[model samples]
Target: MDLSAINPVLLLASLLVAATPLLLAAIGETIVERAGVLNLGVEGMMITGAICGFAICVNTGSPVTGLVAAAIGGAALSLVFAFLTQVALANQVASGLALTLFGLGLSALLGQNYQGIKPPSFPRFDIPLLADIPVLGPILFRQDPVVYLALALTLATWAFLKFTRAGLILRAVGENHDAAHALGYKVIRIRTLAILFGGALAGMGGAYISLIRVPQWTEGMTAGIGWIALALVVFGAWKPLRVALGAFLFGGIEVVQLNLQAAGVAIPVEILAMSPYLITILVLVIMSADRSGAPASLGRSFHASH
Candidate 1:
């Protein structure tokens, strides 16, 4: 194994790129869970978004429009989950699983014409002076716009949960929907909106994979990133910053193992490839033994009587 063959800087840079989708999906789910609703259809939402974004970007020749379409597609699909769970009082877990299956099948249909197609290029901004720094510059500044957006999103989510009145109210509804309803808060509406937000973000994350990561459409291109994002939320205890931190850790593992494969390491190719996912999941699963910080009413159906 030629350890020297791996370029540390490039490895870290790729890690950031790899983790972007995971962070986006995980953080969005964190919000949904915090609102006391658990949507397990992230995989479904992501794949739909991936196809939507890829198709739009290819036709319109604009990555921005493609991303917007992705978000809309995701939100529209999530509307089904919202109505079923919040309004119809259907089972959230089952609804989410159904949504995933539906999304996979639907995306496959939509993406049939888009197979083997490449998407339009997305521009990255180079911070004038900061991007000029020796080692840190390329790793930090020379990144996809979505990477910066994901970071900003983490900070924004943290602040919203910690300092905003709206945030407090959302937290309250999540903690005790009955009490929140008694106090005049609209539990179902809040949760529906949260679910939509989660879907939109998950969609964007999916688009990132097709439009930026692989920049191509493939059946099951998302693999299990959506499921991994769910695990990340649990690993991070549903906190925005911690979720981001966990994404980076798992993302780093993804990059490291790929580097190992490229370096022609003696380890079995299958083992090297799977180690990032298996180790990340096992480690995070082990660390998540204490679920004390989870939102109290998470995954519970809330029927508001007003």
Candidate 2:
């Protein structure tokens, strides 16, 4: 392998690009899980958002509108789950799975006319003084708005979960729903809001993919990134900064795999493509083995009577 063929700066930049979607989705899922709602439909929601964003961007010739539409689409899908879990008090896990299936079917139906179309490009923002620097300039300073937004969301999520009163109540609800309910907090309402927020962020991540990363429409375009994001929340022990770190790690692996293939490395393309998912399973196993930091009520349903 000609290691010199890989530019460290370019590799880092690619990692950032690949990591953004995962960061957004995982952070949002972290919030959802923290509020005692487990949504496994993230993959479906993301792909639906991807197609929705791509279609809207192509039709309107505007990436911004596409992203907004993606957020709306994702949130709308999540509302279904909220209705089932909150109003009907259905099983959270089952409802999430159904959401994924429904989103996939709906996105495919809506995207039939959008096949092979390219969406408008998202504009990149270059930091003033920093963007003018030599080799580091393009790598660090130039990126689409979502890249910066993902990082900002990480910090904001950390602060929200750690400092804000609403955040504290959300955490309390996740930790012990019975206690939070006794305290007069609307458990269902809080969880519903959290689920919607998660969906919107996940949708934005999907939009980033369609509008910027791949810049095209395809069925199941998100592949398994949503599942990876779910695993990342677990890998990070539901912490924002750690989840971001996990996203970067997976993103780096993906970038390296692609770059290696492009450079004519002897590795099989299938193996390289599978590396990201393999790593996700390994990380999940490691996290489960430790089992020290997982949210107390993850995947557990809460009822007022229980």
Top candidate by TM-score? 1
What lDDT tens digits, residue by residue, belong to model 1 across residues 171-246?
A: 9988989999999998989999999999999999999999999989999999989999988898888889989999
Residue-wise C-alpha lDDT for candidate 2, range 127-210, written one tens digit per residue: 889888887887878877889889999999999999999999999988888889999999889998999999998898998887
What's the C-alpha lDDT at position 301 in model 2?
Answer: 74
- Tell me how candidate 1 scores on lDDT: 0.91
How close is every model to the real structure, measured as TM-score?
Answer: 0.97, 0.97
Clash-forming residue pairs, model 2: none
Question: What is the lDDT of every predicted structure here?
Answer: 0.91, 0.88
> What's the CA RMSD of model 2 in angstroms?
1.3
Off by over 4 Å in 1: none
Measured with C-alpha atoms, the lDDT of residue 203 in candidate 2 is 90
